[model samples]
Target chain A: MTDCKLCSLEEYLKLIEHEEITYAQPHKPAIPGHVLMIPKQHVAIIEQIPDEEFGKMMVQANKVSMALFESLQAQGTNIIIQNGISAGQKDPHVCVHVIPRREEDGLNFLWVPKTLNEEEMSTIELRIKENLTVQLKPKEVEPPKPEKVTDDYLLKQLHRIP
Target chain B: MADMSPEQVEELKEKLKNMSPEELREFQKKQCIFCHIVAGRAQAKKVYEDEHCIGILDINPANPGHVLLLPKEHYAIMPQIPDKEIMHLGITAKKLSHALLRALHADGTNIFIANGVVAGQKAQHFMIHIIPRKEHDEVGIDIPEKLLSKQQLQQVKQHILPSIAKSLGARLQEQPVAVEQVSPKEQSAVPAPRHEPREVVIEDTPRKAQPKAPKKEHPKKDQTKDEDVTLDDIADLLGGS
Candidate 1:
């Protein structure tokens, strides 16, 4: 708690201050107009958040994004979170980074790559697909009909079919 | 839109000369549109809701099934949120990211935020974007990699490893959740044990003492920077914190 900078945001330079959530200009930033959105509490991560407040935070995040696109006229955006050390989280207090992007931002986050094999892909497909936001499955492709086959060819094929 | 009376305007002008950025931050939040959404005054195509946050469809989405998640209460940025709420948000986002991918049949998914204006934040309210990604979606998040020398990597690790360790608080320190050792699959299966940091210490002290004081107190001295403070540098500083 003593080390949590987010809980002590009042002591910092805030860009947008609210009763519960606070949007502050990050001292360090990845893009122009970069900002961090966080809760007023000292909880370290997102799951610890109450669902209602989490809802509000979600709203704020979107609104800010809309503003980025409209008010700031940003052509692109990338909102990212680094969870654990491996994921690149810097501090314990979880802050969402709202990055306004253009085609030329030359963005990089020390991202490492992993190549998923077919089995690994299927396993991931099984696990993460639960509670899908969109439930409609893609329709299967139909086999192509042979347009060149004339009535005689069809008759011949029919004889073979029997 | 600043609805102040002429006299109030004059008073505000009088205050403006001495007004701090902190005060202006409050003023901005009071007029924030998302705050209206949370308070039931505004309308949105909300997709998910719980005690902590609401997830709504993004009006300007990178792809279909894009979600904007926010807290019920307004806070400007990310650092102010308590660890538990942040943790909850992360967990919920993970679930939604999965759902978004399944629902949209997308090849991949991304969850991110523009933490500051330099990072592309427009609205002052805090939110997280859950975007479903496919090949050739062209979202433009492909950041080029800069390979560091072993010595430089060691220096960075030596500096930041401890700061991150301290954020674990007493609870995590005791259990020592080794993140590097946890595979992505294993982490997702039972996320709670991996996620549970020490709540008692955080909930009791800073939570109780969280400031709601008037803004005229602290002198705003941070240079409203327009420079590119890269993620790597921020990561390093945060690690060293």
Candidate 2:
């Protein structure tokens, strides 16, 4: 097994680096304006990423997509996340691919939609409903305040500790 | 309306162009079938629902448990969404991905968003497609490798880097002074200092060592010129005939 390239992140061209996420251009990109929003920490999959971290990535992705549209004059953009191995995830690290799309770009994300019977659809729906717990909400963006300890307060705390 | 004459399409496009943003949104909501589905006015097999988002099984699913997670409020594209709402939708997508894995026993999932008609965005309302995947399913979304020359990559970087920085900088300026002060890490990592071209080829050797990457299905279609899809096509999608 090889080391995760995203974790090192030394080689990739860095674009916008936030605390939780690093937006960069892939070394060997699928397209010219293709960029990736990757978590700073080594998170293996989307399910394992913290909600706040994932949220930050998505927000950055939107910003990047907007930039692609305005700056590159890209006609469209695709935000794609291949979550696990079976979904064509080349890297173990969770990275969101933001590709700038032009007309005749030769990249097609369109899939042949398969028609499922009523029974299958209903069964899958029931199963998904049973497993899904959808109460997860993004918490209000409040930066944690570190308590300021004055010199006098530290001295008093030291006396109390003794 | 898909069969509307080009002249009629032109007329509708003109009509859409004249409307205000608020009016455009209202018109979009009226035209969008997904908005109706989100509002519970139309029928869908909903798998999950909360205050901000709803998840329903895709009628013509790529896979068995394919889910379309949509925001309750109608938005035309991902960029139109506010930061808070986009976050909510993303977290919801993660949860739905988990649910698909747990319920369908699927091997993987793909979280997909197409922002314009050119990008395969069929509906006016923005939604996230969470397609459950298995081995050899043939829902080929494998991005073909199209490596850019170094100069081309640099040009792309030059174009995109400032745009992102400007957008983020504007947001940061609007934030509280304390919030901006806290992220010295972000301040240090801004794009200006990193403009020097570093050795990119050195890192290529390590990535090349990993040959165990899964074989992707390259569903080669005869490449067709689709430059006909214009912003008017987006307006047509928003009109939702």
Candidate 3:
């Protein structure tokens, strides 16, 4: 089993720079300067990560983007994450791709659409509408009773060296 | 020791019980403390509160003094919001913006609404981001320029007009009894009939003053002018490409 990478930011940085992790691109050599912000834990996808960790990841991603701007002189950047195979995820690791973009670079990533028949289109539309309606409908929920974890204890646990 | 009275707790519980499932989900996602605060389970730095909505300081702000305006009854996007709850969220955002300007001494502000996941909406709950903007702080928000053709612009205008009209119709329905009772004929008689949408009419009138006149002298001027206009604006005018 792959060990949890959460404790060592330095080790995580090294792995990102090593280029073997095909799922995430390293900041150096590829796009001149690009960074991949990822959870050190082996979380398969965003849905699997806890809410607090997810929020912290977002904050880190933002910080990395800011660093890219300052260091690389990046004019623009794109924050992308491929969740499932259908969304083009080749790896199971949950990571956010931070790609720095420049003006008139001809880096086109547009997707070409295949035409669908009228019946097929109608079927897809109907299915989506039905799903949305169902999702909006109310459901019973068990009362939310949060576990008592003090801030100090949680902080120490999160920051502990592996 | 209790911060809120028993009656206040009961009032909050009643509101929570009446909330739709979608609203509850939104509250769970966006207003993290609302559920905890309501249950007397968490303490939060509350900025503003009313029966329908609440404003609070964002724990992790894009900039200092960033505030979030959330509806007590949750809806994801502005379009999904009910007519009655319209002014409540918008007014709260406006008030917070003013407060940020006065208290934080911000240069400008951006009222951002990321509607869905595609739009970078992290929280499923409908929340308005009252981000206080500074002149030179690199926040990493980039707006792509899209070029559009004349035909696309016309198509978009045609498609959106009906939806805009429907929204206006819904708004009119919520007017006071006497105002609602007035027929289209009476309304028209009261105000001059305008072809443009009421909202558009107010904003568009200023543009008519600066009529485009073809300049014959400098050929370089035309090239520079084209460069000045953003590709996004062109794309918007032409419809999405």
Candidate 4:
């Protein structure tokens, strides 16, 4: 954790402290007014974080975006969270980019065209639809281990009492 | 640019096999410019910060006042993100969008996420792009016209509907869950964190939350200007644009 800079970014970035997350600027931003919203904890993935904490993270991101519009002369905005290395995530830390837009800023985020045929499109849509349907179940609470406090031990106590 | 050469794909795949999540995380930490900034090893033009996330200026932007929001912990990608964190991130992005409107008096805003390398993603970290928009902005989102015809769209819909229902659950089955505009106290209790935030986005002059449209782009950024720009606005923008 000590080696992970994300765990210790607060001192470096002049952050607006909050109850849940911190807001600051990116060192090498793709655009002006770029900012980063980081959770206070050292979580590697969203799934690993508690649901409520994750909720707080989103609240913080939305708040920062609102702040940008309120304080700066912003026109339009983009909020992006790249999830995986395959998804173009660079740092191990998770970041949401809230980019401000105006007429003709000319930053092309376009990718090379790879037109999917009808069959492929159908396939892809189906995949997303399928995956999107799956709900995230609440993690099951683990019972205490047998070594720590086993049902067998309780049974033995019950027999001894009888 | 999003497309990689065959060798590049092979190389990446090979790298994946050799790298454990921890090793990959460390590798990313080492090369992560954001982390270095958080560690005081580098510098940044900041915007704002709180306990959970950081907002900072983008050096290269599609428009002025662009901001990047990042989580303090290391999360590789979106699919890997838990549902709660996803919701949290989404809400924060919306507020930041509103912030840009209030502060800069910009026209409209766009929230973009390139999920994969093929989707124009260049960063290994998760980043949400909050961009302000004006009429006829040269920065084109460039989504091609309908990829499927009406009949095809129908077929795709039918194929996906069952799974969408199964996975998305209540949100899709019923009215959308209003995940935005949360007041602070409504938030749940959080323990002290291990990650410290870095970077800052200074508000030259802070403004209160207001619903007025931006001055630069005229006649309301969206047709429903007076109305609250709900999360659906972004979805509509992406769908209709």
Which candidate gets the maximum TM-score versus the true structure?
A: 2
Rank ordering of all candidates by lDDT, starting from the highest? 2, 1, 4, 3
Candidate 2 Cα deviation (angstroms), residue B93: 0.4
Question: For chain B alone, what TM-score does every candidate structure achieve against the true structure?
Answer: 0.59, 0.66, 0.54, 0.60
Superior candidate under lDDT, 1 versus 2: 2
Candidate 4 lDDT tens digits, B70-188: 65555655555665666766666655655665555556566676444434566776676766555554555532222323332232222222222233221222222222221221222
> By the TM-score metric, which is better: model 1 or model 2?
2
In model 4, how well does chain A match by TM-score?
0.68
Tell me each candidate's TM-score. Answer: 0.43, 0.73, 0.36, 0.41
Q: Model 4: how far is B14 from its true place, Å?
A: 7.1
Off by over 4 Å in 2: A133-162, B3-14, B170-241
DockQ-wise, the better of 1 and 4 is 1
lDDT of 3 by residue, B1-241 (tens): 1577999989878988999987767655555545554333765445656787766555556665556677766555444565456545555555555555545556655555454443455565667666555665444343233333333333322222222223222121112111111122122333423232324322221122223232112111111111122233323432322
Error of 3 at A24 (Å): 41
Superposed by TM-score, candidate 1 places the C-alpha of residue B45 at a distance from the truth, in angstroms, of: 1.0
User: Cα deviation in Å at residue B178, candidate 4?
Assistant: 33
lDDT of 2: 0.74
Write one digit per residue (lDDT tens) for candidate 2, span A12-88.
Answer: 77766766677888767777778888888788898888777787778878988997787667789999999888999
Superposed Cα deviation of residue B180, candidate 2 (Å):
28
Residue B200, candidate 4: alpha-carbon lDDT: 26
Minimum summed lDDT over a 10-residue window in model 2 chain B is located at B176-185
Relative to the real complex, the DockQ score for model 3 comes to: 0.01
Regions of model 3 farther than 4 Å from truth: A1-162, B1-34, B37-40, B170-241
Q: Which ten residues in a row have the lowest lDDT in candidate 4 chain A?
A: A128-137
All candidates in order of DockQ, best leading = 2, 1, 4, 3
Mind listing the fnat for each candidate? 0.10, 0.77, 0.00, 0.10
